[model samples]
Target: MHVLFLAPEVWPFKRVGGLAEVAYDLPRALAALGHKVGVVTPKPRLSQEMEQGLERLDTVLEVPVSWKRHLAEVYRHQEPSGVEVYLIGHEHLFDREGLYGNAYGDYEDNAERFIFYSRACLELARTMDWRVDVFHANDWTTGLVPVYLRTLYAGDPCLKDAASLMTVHNLGNQGQFWHYDMPLTGLGWEYFVPEALEFYGQINFLKGGLVFADMISTVSHTYAQEILTPELGRGMEGVLMARRDRLAAVVNGIDYQVWNPADDYRLAANYDRHDPSPKARCRQELMGHYGLEDGGGRPLVAVVGRLEDRKGLDLITAGMERFFEVGLNLVVMGYGEDHYHVALGELAARHPGRLGLTIGFDIDLAHRIMAGVDMLLVPSRYEPCGIHQMQALRYGVVPVVRDTGGLADTVVDQRPGVEGTGFKFEPFTMEAMLQTLDRAKQAYDRPQEWRGLMQRAMAQDFSWQAVAPRYEEIYRKALELAGQRQRA
Candidate 1:
């Protein structure tokens, strides 16, 4: 199959979230599975590794921006597993130091920027005569791909037979903008309907993809079902329900080659599924590095990813004094709201021994934090499907995740013989999380019981080798749908 992935970011090049990581790793695995997979993403400000990695491919294609056209270069990189990556290189649109923006706010012209990129990718693919079998677009940034292919590019020779699959990593960011902006970016006003792009009287880029794409998928099966609800649904329930048969819930996978604790380059000491003692050594190293005590007594709970309200970072902040009261230490690596940043800063200052907070992601430190921490926290309000819990589990860091979305699907609560993988709570409330943590705290006191579950979690597999076939089936299903449409 000839697969073309469209996204705003890709790992090792531009990573602001899990979508980039998926974009980077999944194509490699898909290529290994005998598919011709390639990705088209905005060229991030290049690093030495990035510059060395990508070979210049097709160059200087003009893509329409609001009203005028801008030039972009396409560079290709073949991954170790032989997946070709096409980077859309244009400085004016993507030359910024940050992926999205700095601390103040995202670029005001984000809607126009991503929409232009989406159209550019399709236009480039058409010009290259790449009749994509599956144009799998990730998140809202590239949501316009399916809409453009199905509508404006409907009968174009290169895109006439192409099918699309849009995976909702998280529904919260629906990319809502002023409905009037549609015309400015060349999107038809017909797309701004309640059933299509419009959500709560605004243009919703994410819903446009969900409506027009041949098929839709969320990160996990649980998330797939969860999105069809009123509470969890971000006003897309009706649209999601309309496409019930077209929706799938395949859990996200981790790049074990990079994340494996046993062979991790970031860890202080390598450890396996059997012996987890190195976890303690790694923990001490992490504590020492963060200027915390190296004492091996307090249970270290580390949380990575965005420290936003949606990620349940609020529960952590609300329950900070309680975490220390429960005799636990905290470490965080993420960036978000000013209030969150200031609050976390204060927590780190007030409670030196119990907390360590870094404002943004540190790749090496993230791996070390995963390997070192006794438990990893992902109390997400709504995680479509998280890859961190899987990575933390593989690293022998028992996850204490809120019972929502993929967390509910992946991390099994501690049982008797089943001694499950990690811990789970309900309601997405601090009280609920604290109650579960209390139980986890009790379990932690029983080192033998805790170790059994942590090992069990590490033993579980969340590999792409297991998930790529699911995506393959979905891709085929999209082709089937396209065939039906053609026959009609």
Candidate 2:
């Protein structure tokens, strides 16, 4: 099968979050399975310098916007694994310093920008010599592709039978704009109704895809179920419920080649499940790197990612006193809201050598933490699918996560009778989080049980090798659905 992955960003080229990583890993996995896979992403400003091995292609894409023709230069990057990435270049819209927006806020022109990219994706498919079997779009950025295929380019033979699948990484971030922007879609006003792109009084790009795509999927089965309810759906539960049969939930997988502890160059010492010697060295190195004290026998717990409300970071802040009282050393990495920055910094200062805080993202440090830390903290209020917990498990670092979304699906609570991967807690509150941590700490004291838990976690397979076949099945379902729709 020939597949085209349409996303706003691609990993190692333009990345803002886990979506880019998913955009990078999944296609490569599919290609490795003997499928013809290509990724289409907006050309980032740093592409020329960052994309070392890619060569420019002769293909030029001219996409029709509402009234004008938008021209984009096409460049192709062929991975050694046979996956080809086609970058759409438009200086004004894409070649900015940021993938989506700057520090101030999201770019004001995001609606127009992605609209053009979505339209250009379809046009690029029409112009290319190879016909695509599936046009797989990610998040709200590429939402319009399914809409364009069903409406704007409905009669075009090249894509008339091609299936579209919209994978919602986060329903919280639906691309919504004022109703005035609806005219820019080039879709008829009939599509502006409540059942289509319209959400409340606004034009929602994500709704367009949800209504038009042959199928829809979320990163995890739990998330797919969560989005059908009032609390987690972000106002689209009814729409999702209407098309329940077409929705799927497949857990996102990690790129083992990059994340494997046995081969990771970023770590101080390379160790696998067999040899546990280097893991101790890694822990020592992590302590030295953070300027924290060693030989104290305190369990090292690391929190990596955005420190914000949604991440349930406040629960950590609320339990900081208990964290120290229990003789736990905490290392925090990643930047977010200003208040969290100030709060965490103050806590670090108060705790001195016991707490280590890094305000920004460091890929190397992240890998080191996963390798060295005793536990990883992911207390998200609602996580669609977290990549860090998966990476943590890969390195044999037990994840202590709130039982929600992918965390609920992946992490099994370790008990006296049942050997599990990590620790999990329900009820998104400080009390529950602290109690779970206490349980984990109690388990930490039992070396025999702890080792067994680590072994189980490391033995677990979260790689795309196990996940891609499920995606292939969904792709086939999408094709059948598309064919049925066309026939009707």
| Candidate 2 overall lDDT versus native | 0.89
Tens-place lDDT per residue, model 1, 1-488, is 99998888888788888988899888888998999988998888887876987788745787876677877888888777777778888788788977667767778778877887898889778778887899999888888888888788888988889999999998888887887687756766776778778888888889889999999998988888888999888788989999999999899999989989888887889999889887878987998888876455778888899889888978889899999887788899998778999999998999887798899888988898998888888898888888889999998888899888899999999856666899888887888888878788788889898888888988898998898999999999999998898789
Q: What tens digits encode model 2's per-residue C-alpha lDDT throughout 115-170?
A: 99999888888998567899999999999999988887888878888999999999
Question: What residue runs in model 2 are displaced by over 4 Å at the alpha carbon?
Answer: none
Misplaced by over 4 Å in model 1 are: 294-296, 416-418
| Candidate with the greatest lDDT versus the true structure | 2
Per-model C-alpha lDDT, please?
0.86, 0.89
TM-score attained by model 1: 0.96
| Span of 10 residues, lowest total lDDT, candidate 1 | 184-193
